[model samples]
Target chain A: MPEISYRQAIKDALAEEIERDENVVVIGEEVAQYNGAYKVTEGLLERYGPKRIVDAPISEAGFIGMGIGASMLGVRPVMELMFWSFAYVAWDQIINNASSVRYMSGGLINVPIVIRGPANGGTNVGATHSHTPENLIANMPGLKVVCPATPYDAKGLMKSAIRDNDPVYVMESTLLYGTTGEVPEEEYVIPLGKADIKREGTDVTIVCHGPSVSVAMTAAQILKEEHDIDAEVLDLRSIRPLDEEAIITSVKKTNRAVLVEENRPFCGVDAQIAYTIQNKAFDYLDAPIQRVSTIDAPAIYSPAVEPEQLPKAANVVEKVLSIM
Target chain B: MVGFYREMVRIRRFEERSLRVYQQGKIGGFLHLYIGQESIAVACASLMGDHDHMITAYRNHGHALAVGMSMNECMAELLGKATGCSKGKGGSMHFFAPDKNYWGGHGIVGGQIPLGVGLAYGVKYKDQKGSAMAFMGDGAINQGAVHEAYNLAALWDLPAIFIIENNGYSMGTSQERSSSHPKEGLAARAEGYGMAWEIINGESLFAIRDGVGRAIKRAHEESKPTILEIHTYRYQGHSVADANAKKYRTKEEIDDYRKNHDPLNVYRLFLLDQKIMSEDEMKEIDGEAKQEAEVAAQFADESEFPTVESITEDVYWEADNPDKRTSEGRLFFND
Candidate 1:
C-alpha cells in the first residue's frame, strides 16, 4: 500500500479501467489535449489515444446526454463535467432520461455511465460555478451517488462506478483533491452504499460524507481533547444505497447523533440520515439528533463568508454539544 | 409498396383505437397520435438495415409499429397493462425495444436528438456500418439540445440523420410563428454545423424512401450526418388533452389536409396508379388492419395492471439482481 493524492487515485482508476475494458472511454470538455480542467485526466489522452479519450465541445447538455445515450448502447462512458454546477444544463438528460430510461423501458436498457466532477462550495467560484448536488442526485431513485473523501475510497469507488450496471454520479471535491490517503496497488472496488468508521467512539455519533468527513473527524478530535466526549466519525463513502445500517449502529452505541454535509439544510443528505437514525435507533437515543449543514443559500460568492457557509468542525462540535 | 401500405395502415388503425380508448378514459397519460404522418415512420422502417437504429419523440406509435413491435404490446402500454412493451412503466410517451435497435419514444422536445447522435457514435465505435435516425417535430428544431447534437454529429462525423417531421403546427403554435426561417427554412440550419441538409415531401412514401435512403447511405458509406426536414401533418390534437385542436386551426385546413394530402390516401393513389396491388386487396388489407387494432384494444382491456408489489422493481439493476450487486446498505429507503 502507498499514500496518494485523491486526484492521482482517480487517474489511476481510470487508466486501469480503460485498459481492462475496451468499451470504457472518457468523454468530456478539456479531458483530452487539455488533460481536463482539473488535470485529473493528464496523460490519459496520450495513453489511450483519441478514441478512448474524447474531447467534447463545451456543451454539457450535448455531451452529457450523448454519454447517456452511448451508455444505452454498448459503450461504457466515463463522462466528466468541469464542474457539477454545469450539470444543471443537462438536468433533463440526467433526471428525465438517464435516471428513468431503464425503469421506463421496463429494465430493457441501463445507463452504465459515470459522471464525475468537483461539486462543492468555498472555491471562490461564484454562484454559477459552485454547487453541491449529491443530495439532489441521491434523491433520484434510479441513479446512484458517491462522495469519496479519501484517496483509497476515490480509487475503489471510481472503479466500481465504472463497473456498475446503473448510472453512478461521483461527486469529487476540488478542496480535497490534494489530500492523501493509503491506496493499494492491487485491483479493488469499494462497493456503493457502504460506510467506514473513520474514528470510533461511544459518547456521540458524527456521521458525514465527502468533504464533511474531514470536518467530522476534526470535530471528533476537538470533542475528545477539550469536551472529554469520545465522538464517533462515520464517513458515508457513497450517498445513495446509503449506509443507514452503519449510521444506526453508531447512533445506537453513542445514544446521540450529529449528521453533517456540505449541502443546504432543507432536504439535504443529512436530513435523510437524521430521519433514518430516529426511525431505526429511536430507543437508543439519549437526546434529539442534531446536524450541521451548509447554510440555506445555494451558493455564496464572498470568499470570506463562503468558509462559514460550509459545515465547519466548530459548528459540528456545537451541534454535538447541543444534542449531548 | 404494399408492405409499406400495410405498415402505414396498421399504425393508423392502432392510433385511431388508442385515441378512442384515450377519449373513453381507458388510456392514461398523453396520447400523441401519428395520424397524418404515417408515411415518414413507415418509409424509414422499411429502409432500415441490420445496423440502422431509429428514435422518435412522443408521437411514436407509428415508429414503434413500423419497426415491427406488436400492436398488442403497444396498446397494452397505452392501457398501462402488465404485458405492455415497457411493462406499463412507460406509458404512451416512452416505448423502447433495444433488441430491434429502436432506442425510444422520448418525451422531451429535443432531448432525444443528442441521444440519437450518441447512438450513431456507438455505431462508429463498434465499427458497425450503420446510422441512427433521430426524428423530431418542427418544434424541436429550435431547442438548444438539437443544435448541440448537430454540432457533435458534424464534428465527430457520427452517422446521425437528424430528421425533423415538420408537421404544419407545433402544438397549437403554427410553424410560421414558433421558429425563425433563414434563407432555406429550418433544415438549412445544418449548414452552420457544416452538415448536409435537405427537405422532403413527407406525404409521399416514395419521396421518403429515396431521400431517407440516400441519407442513410451517406451515414453508412461516408460516416456523415444529415438533417432532413420531412414536411408532414397531424390530423389529431397535439395530445388528447389539447382542447383547441380544431379551435387553433380552421376546419377547412384540417379538411384540406385530410382530403388532398393524406399520407395514406396519397400513397394509396400512387400504389393504385402503379398497379402495386388490386383495389380489392387494398380494401382487404385495411379491414385486416382495423380488425388487428380491435383485437389489440380488447387484449389491452383484459390485461392486468402491474402488481402493487412490483412498484419497486426495475428502479435499480443491482436491486433487481442481488447476485451481481456488490454494494452494501439500503438501495431503497422507503417502504
Candidate 2:
C-alpha cells in the first residue's frame, strides 16, 4: 500500500491510461501548459506532450461538444471542467448530446468520454463557482455518475471510467483533493455502483458519497465515543447505478439509516436513496429514515453562512440522535 | 448535371409528401421540411468523399436523401417505425447513420457545431484523408458554441467545413432581428476566428458545388476548416406545426421566391438548357421522384413499431452485449 493524495491518484490514472491507449487524450482549459486550475492534471502535458494533453479555450460548450464528437469516432477524451458549475453553460452538449448519442444512434456510436472536475460547495467561491451537480447529471439515462470519497477510489474509478464505453461523469471535490489515503500502486479498478462500509457498526447506518463521506465518518466516530452509539459509515462510490441492494441490506441489519450529502435537499441524491430504503427495508427499520443535506437555497458567499448552508458532521450526528 | 437535378426533384417530392402525411396526422413529432433548400444538400453531398462525415440541424430530410440513405428508411424514421435508420427511436429531428458517415440531425440550434469539429479532429488524429461538414441555419451562427467551435477548428486546423444555410429566419424571427451584425452577413464573423470563409448563392447548384468543392479540397489537402455561408430559403413554414408562416412574411414575397428561385425548377431548367435532358426527360425524372416518394410512404406505413421488450434496450451499448453484460453483472456488489 502507498500513501498518496487524491490529486495524485487522478494524475496516475490519466498517465496510465494515456500510456495504455494511444487514443486517450486529456483536453481542457489550463490543462496543458498551465497544468490545471486545481493542478489535478499537473505534469500530464509534460509527459504526454501537446497532442495527448490538449489546451482548450474558455468555451465549455465548444470543447465539451468536441470531446463528445471525438469520442464517437473512437477517441477516448478526458474532458476537464474547471468547475462542475461551469457545465451549465454546456448543459445541452452534456445532457442531450453526450448522454443520448449512443441511444439515439441505435448503438452505432458510443461516447467513451470521461467528464471530470470538482463539484463542491462551502468553499466561499460564491454562488456561481460552487455547485454539486452529481444529482442533476445522474438524472440522465445514458450517463454514469461516480463520486469517489477517497484517493484509492478516485484513482481506480478514473481508470475504469476511461476504459468504459459509455459517458461517465467523475465528480471530484476540492475539499478531498488534498486529503491523503492509502492507495495500491498496482493496477486495480474499483468497479462502479459498489458501496463500501468504511466503519462497520450494529446501531445505525450513515449513507453518503463524495465529500459527505468524511462528514459521516467523523460523525460515526463522535457518536461512538460520546453517545455510546455504534454507527455504520457506508460510502456510495457510484450514484447513477445506485447500490440499492447494499443500502437495503445495511438498513435491514442496522434497522435505521440516515443519508448525508452536500447537495441541496430538493431532488437530491439522498431523496432517492431514502425512498429506496423506505420502499425496500421499511419493515426492518425501528426508526424513520432521515436525511442530512445542505439547505434548500442558493449557496451563500460568506464563510459563516456557507458552512451553515452545507452539511456538517454535527448535522449528521443530530439526525442520528433524533432518530434514536 | 442531370443527377443533381434528379436528387433535387427526389428531395422536393419527399418533402411534399411528408407535408401531406403530416397534415393527415400520420407523422408525429417535429416535421421540418427541406422543401425549398434541396440544392444545398445535393451539391454538398455530391462533393464529399466516401469517408467524409456530415452533421446538420433538424431540417435534414434532404441531407439524408442526398447522402444516399434509402427513402424507405428516412420515411420510416419520420413515421417512427422500427425499420428506420435510427431504429425508430430518433424521429425526424435525430436521423443518424454511422455506416454512411451521417452523424446526426440535431434539434438544438447550434448543438452540432462542436461535434462536427470533433469529428474532424478524429479524422486528423487517425490520419484519415477525409473531412467533416456541419450544416447549421443562419440563426445558429450567433451561438457562442458555434463561435467556440470555429476558434478551435482554426487553432487545431481540423478539416471541418461549417455550412450556414441562411434561410432568412430561425423558426419565426428573421436573421436581421437575431444576428448582431446582420448587415455584413454571417460569413464576415468567420474572419474573427481566423478561418478561411466564403459566401455563395444557395440557389445555384454550380456555385454551391464549386464553393464546397474548393473548401473540401483545401480540407483534404491542408487540414483547414472553412466557413461557407450559403444564401438559401425555405418555402414552407419551419415545421409542419408552423403553418402560419404567411402571417409573418407576405404572400407576395413567398410567391416571388417560389416562382423565380425554386431550386428544383431552376436545376431542371439548367439541365434542359445544358442539353443534358429534354423536356420529356425532365418530366420522366419528376414522375420517377413522385413514384419513389409514394413507395417510401407505403413502406413506412407497412413497417411495425419496435417490440415493447426493447424499450429498456439500447440505452447503453454494453447492455446489448450478452458477454459483457453477464461479466459486468457479476462485478456488481449485490450479485
Candidate 3:
C-alpha cells in the first residue's frame, strides 16, 4: 500500500481500467491532450490512442448520451461532466436515456457507463460550478452514485463502477484532489453499496461521504481528544443504493447520530441519511439526528462566503456537540 | 431481410391500430405514427444483422416493430398496459426495447444522435462488425446535439450510419422555412465532418434498401461513418392527434404526394409489375393487416393495468427489491 492523493487515485483507477479492458474508453471536454480540467485523466491519451481517450466537443448531452449508447453496444465509457452544475444541460441524456435505458428496454441492455466529475461548493467556483448530486441523481434507480473521500476509495470504487453492469455517477470534489491516502498497489475494486467505518465509537455516529468524510473524520478526532467523546464515523461510499445497514448499525451502537455533508441543507444527502437513521434505528435513538451542512446559498467567489457555504470541521463538531 | 413484407404488414397494422387507440383515448402522450415512413425503417432494418443496433426519435413504432419487438407488446405499450415493453411506464413517446436492440423512441429532438454514435462505438469495442443506424428527422439536423454527435462519429471513425429522414418538415414548419438550405439538410453538413454522404428517396424501397445496405457495409467493413439522407414524408402531422394543416401546402401538393409517393402503394405497384404477387394477393395482404390491427387493439383493450407496485419495477435490474427503496431514512424538523 502507498499513500496517494485523491486525484492520483482516480488517475490510477482510470489508467488501470483502460489498460485492462480495451473496450473501456474515456470522453469529455478537456479530457484528452489537456489531460483533464482537473488532470484526473493525466497521461491517458498517450497511453491509449485518441480513439479510446476521446476529446468530445463541449456538448454534455451529446457526448454523455453517446457514452450511454456505446455502453449499450458493449463499450464501457467513462464520461466527465466537468462540474456537477453543468450536468443540468445533459439531463435529457442522463435522466431519460442513461438512467432509463435498462428499464425502458426491459433489462435487455445495460448502460455500463460512468459519468464522473467534481461536485460540491469550494474555492470560489461560484454558483455555476458549485452543486451536489445527492438529490439530483440519488432517486434515479438505474444509476449508481458514489463519491470517494480518499485516494484509496477513489481508485477502488471507480474500478468497481467501470466494471459493474449499470450506469454509475462518480462525484469527485474539486477541493480534495490534493488530499492523500494509503492505496493498495495491486489491482483491486471496492464494491458499491458498501460503507467504510473510518472510526469506531459509542457516543455518536458522524456519517459523511466525499470531501465531507474527511471533514467528519477531523471533527471526530477533536470530539474524542477535547470532549473525550468517541464519535463513530461512517463513509457512505455510494449514495444511490445507500448502505443503510452500515448507517443503521452505527446508529444503533452510538444511540446518537450526526449526519455530515458539504451540500446545502435543503434536500441534501444529510437529510436522507438522517431520515434513514430514524426509520431503521428509531429504538436506539438517544436524541434527534443532527446535520452538519452548508447553508442554503449559491457558492460565492468570496473566501468569506465560500467558508460559510461549505461544511467545515468546526461545524461538524459543533453540530455533534449540540446533538450530544 | 428475413421478414420484409411481414414487417411492413406488422408496422402498417401497428400504426393504424395505434391511431384507433389514440382516438379512443387508449394511447396517451405524443404519438408520432410511422405510416408512410415504414419503407425507410423496413428497408434499412432489413439490411442490418443482429450485431447492428438502431436508435431514433419519437416516430419509432415502425423501427421498434421492424427490429423484432412483438406487435402485442407494442400495442400494449400504446394502450399503457402493464405488459407493455416499458412495463407500461413509458407511452408512445418513450417506447424502448433494448433486447431487440431498439434503443428508444426518444421524445427530445436529436437526443438519440449521440447515443447512436455511442452504440456504434460499443459495437466496434466488442470486436463486432456493424454500424448503428441512427435515424433522425430533417428537423433534428438543426439540433446542436446532432452536429456534436456527427463530428465525433466522423472523428473517431465509429461505425455509425447517421440517417436523416428528411421528411421536408419540422412539425409543420417545412424544411424550406426551418432550414437555411433545405435540399441538402444534413448531407450538406456532412462535408464539414469529413465523412462521405448519400441521399436517397425514402419512398423508394429499392433505393432505401440499397443505400442503407451500402452505408451499413461501408461502416462495418471500412470502419468509416457515413451519412445517408433518406428523403421521406410524414403523412400525418407531428403526432396522431394533430390536424392535417389546411395551409401548410396546397391541396394539389398533398394529392400528388398521396397518389404518386405513398410508400405502401409504390411498393405494392412495383410488386404487381414484377409479378412478385397478384393484385388479389395485395388486397388480401391489406385485409390481413387490418384484421391484425383489430386483434392487436382487442388485446390491448383487454390487457390489465399495471399494479401500484409496477411503479417501482424496471427502474433497476436488481433481481430482488424491485420497488427501488422509497423511504429515505430522515426526518423533517420545521423551524
Among these predictions, the greatest lDDT belongs to 1
Sliding window of 10 residues with minimal summed lDDT for model 2 chain A: A99-108
* Model 3 lDDT per residue over B156-183, tens place: 7889999999877888888777776535
Measured against the true two-chain complex, the DockQ scores of the candidates, in the order shown, are: 0.87, 0.50, 0.39
Specify the highest-TM-score model's number: 1
lDDT of 2 by residue, A1-324 (tens): 889999999999999999999999999999999999999989888888998999999999999999999898999999999999999999999999998888776777889999999999978989899999999987887788999999999999899889888888999999999999999878998777778898899899999999999999999999999999999999988896677778888889999999999888889999888877887888999998899999888888999788888888999999999989
Query: How does residue B1 of candidate 2 score in lDDT?
Result: 78
Share of true Cα-Cα contacts across chains kept by each model: 0.80, 0.54, 0.54
Q: Is the docking of candidate 3 incorrect, acceptable, medium or high quality?
A: acceptable
> Where in model 2 is the C-alpha error above 4 Å?
B182-184, B326-335
Per-residue lDDT of model 1, residues A1-324, tens digit only: 799999999999999999999999999999999998899999999999999999999888998888888899989999999999999999989788889989989999989989999998888888888888999999899999999999999999999999999999999999988899899989899989899999989999888999899999999999999999999999998999888889888888889988899888899988888888888889999999887888887677888888988889999989888876
Worst 10 residues of 1 chain A by lDDT: A294-303
Model 1 TM: 0.99
Query: How many residue pairs clash (N, CA or C atoms closer than 3 angstroms) in each of the candidate models, in the order given?
Result: 0, 0, 10
Model 3 DockQ vs. reference = 0.39
Model 2 lDDT tens row, B1-335? 78998899999999998888788898887899998899999999998886699999899989999999989999998888889888888889888888888999898999999999999999998999989999999989889899989999999999999999999998899987888863567887877878888999988999999999999998999999999999888988888889788887989989988989887778777877889899998889889999999999999999998787666667766667756641132122121
lDDT for B104 in candidate 3 is 85
- Among the numbered candidates, top DockQ falls to 1
Clashing pairs in 1: none
